[model samples]
Target: LWWCPTGLLTLLPLHAAGYPDPADTPAGRTVLDRVVSSYTPTLRALARARKADAPATADRRLLAVSLPEPPPGGVALSPLPGARAEAAFFERAMPGSHTLRVGDAATHATVTADLRTHAYAHFACHGSQDVNDPSTGALYLWDKPLTVLDVAELDLAHAELAYLSACHTAVGGATLPDEAIHLAAALQLAGYRHVIATLWTVGDRTAVDVATSVYTSLVDGAGLDLADTAHVLHRTVRALRDADPRDPTRWAPYIHSGA
Candidate 1:
């Protein structure tokens, strides 16, 4: 586990830090190369997510959203070319997974309503971070931003996992170092048992590929287990880091933020 000792640390990806020397042996040199990691805003929040394990069954549902449109009055966001691939991965890897593709149908209300019905969720879209008001940080939808406060208001007992493939989903306010007022923590507060989120803005292509690899590993022939997810991400990120030893940004932003 990585510790965020200050507000600045909350904005950085501590888990992604690499070896002090390039020539150093790859074995156990980085967090990703060693243990399965889970991020928690606090020890209490971590305990809540681990209280119950996700049930393994064919009926397990995943709600995937891909928002390719720019929001009203918001800065224009280039459509995520990787969103389709990310959505397709969930559909193929998880049984009974459903997708809300980028289109007229994938509205905010629609996605919010679907959240209540699904056990897992994947959001492939733009994220807005309000540095002054961390609770206002949001994940963009077709109609509006799904703010952190909106997520906290939810009572989703059935929700088990959430993959936030967006920018700075785990970033919190500089003013509130201990509160953890960010999208990743908000989702956990809302009831997700495990959450895969990014610590900063991520590359479009790498995000899709890494997200796919993580899910594929978790849902291997045996089936998906929530406890195994952290290791799955660790292995996948390590592989990405191995492919390019110099670029920690490519593999380091992603983190498992719950049980």
Candidate 2:
């Protein structure tokens, strides 16, 4: 598991914090080079969050949200043109899932209510991380933001996985990293078994590719085992890393948490 140090340590990659390669081979070159890493806000939270295992594939139901436009009075966030594409990809990739896209159709009330019934969820939109109070962090919905505090108030007993294709959903406060105050952790606290989140602002197009690869692997039985999601992510990220080894920013920001 990974835990980034709060405060000045945010610049470091705690998950990839090891030393030189082992003499034997390339296995231990770095913490990231070998490990199938996962992140958590705190050790206790991690333990609590793993109380339940991910549900079976047959039982999975997805709720996908994609907001390409910034809300009224909110500055343009470089329109995530890929958001619609991501949603459509999932609808076809994971057939029989519910999708709430840009329009008068997806609202804060509808999205939150849908959370309780769905086993999995995906969000492709702009995200805001509240530096002073990480708990106030949120992912933009059609009408408003689904704040971390708001997520914590829900009881999602059937929730199995959540993929936040937005920015900084996994980032915690620089002062209190162990407090588990961000949106990803808040979803865990609300009973989600697994969450895939970003550590910082990520490339919009890259985010879509990662999400596509992940869901496709999870649904296509011929691909990697969905039961071993960490391994699935490891392979996916490694492929992305191999494509452009120089840009760690693209692949490194996405991390899986929980079982």
Candidate 3:
């Protein structure tokens, strides 16, 4: 299912909606159990993503950015100790095909430059959504924040998947309710064929587990197959849901966007 939600509907986790209790529905009631869901800002956006050429096999490099600690002289945000684990998983999974940038190395400039060169990008950090102005929403880095506007301005021709392990990446501004102007949408606008984002704040430990499972299923001896991304995420989330059937919070926030 390719969802193109407008206004407040964009803020909800439609893919996870349905009866949470297994006893209520024998075959499982969630949208996730029924189909592999992905979001797009519009039908035209989906069409454009589908029309774009796939990234070359040789160019399937991964850029993994990890910001476990907050930047110096800034608003004191809680540290994400699990980001390091997530970064390490990417290194182990991709090995020679990955660039691991952590701590002071994950600067806005470096990440932006790396995005242009890498076919796949993964950000494990703090994400802030400016509810007043969604375009100002950003993924916190070393030097500064990589704003939605910053991402939307870029033209990443080789871009494939961008797994945003940070929080509220898919949440749009309440002020501009109809506008699809969040970090996830911005990445799609920047030319990423697919994006994995969260609808709200997610636990650091949970993020690590989800990333590990999702990537494990997606990665092969050669490299990641972008075609399997949505289904892989669906399966991963279903497993998570099965582990704790009552707590949708543990599994539902993670969403896939674009092609």
Candidate 4:
């Protein structure tokens, strides 16, 4: 098999029907054919050249665990209070029914909690990708120190949506399990309906602001047909981009989504 990074990026966009779902057209097939053709050669060459073993993603099937029933003390969903008094203009735009978990920085609890229950989950934290050691790429919670250990244990099956709302958790490693962006792949493998992650860093304030707007729109029922968190995140981030294109902080976090 051959490997071509260009295909997943360019072909998917040129042929996609929309976010979370790409078009499976002749063009799409061509892209896929190339990816299939490229894989074997890419792997063999990389292994031979680098002399480094790649991570295992042999279980190509997405984790299809049935959604776990809400257990006792399932989730503690709450909005960031007091801070609301000082909410940026973006905060006021938030509508009702947006079940968010807010803290000084509660990324870990929020993620762990969201995995256990809920149709939608949002997070604003610091995340990084590891091109060299794909498994080490991880998210940095506002409150907790994020590591691969945490993500490895997450039950992603119940999570219909996961919005990383931070920098580059979307990128996939080169190998099957090695997509440098393990977060998205892992979420897909764990059976999440959708996982939305970023490819680069964003300003903390900007991230919170974008998340505020998008989740607000979602809670108001704008994403009725949206199948993936990436769609919601894309909409939100794009709005921010339009609001201020010059803000490198806004555009840097490219989407690495699995829908």
1 or 2, which is superior by TM-score? 1
Candidate 4 lDDT, tens digit per residue, 1-259?
A: 2223432342122211222224353323322122212111133333442332222222111111111111123233223222232233223433342344334324457546645554444444446676566676665544554555566677544344555654556555555545433565555444444455565555555655665555455443322233333445555555554465455445535443333
Give a tens-digit lDDT track for model 1, residues 158-253: 788899999989888878653499899999888888888987889989988888888876674434556688878888887897788688778888
**Which RMSD values do the candidates have, in order?**
2.4, 3.5, 1.5, 13.0
List, residue by residue over 136-182, the lDDT tens digit for candidate 3. Answer: 89999999999988987899987889999999999987854536989
Number of clashing residue pairs, candidate 4: 20
Provide the TM-score for each candidate, comma-separated.
0.90, 0.86, 0.95, 0.52
Model 2 TM-score on a 0 to 1 scale: 0.86
- lDDT score at residue 167, model 1, on the 0-100 scale: 90
Weakest 10 consecutive residues, lDDT, candidate 3?
19-28
Candidate 1: stretches off by over 4 Å: 2-6, 24-27, 53-59, 71-73, 99-101, 177-179, 220-223
Across 27-63, the per-residue lDDT of candidate 2 in tens digits comes to 4556677677877655666776667765555456778
In candidate 3, which residue ranges exceed 4 Å CA deviation? 22-25, 176-178
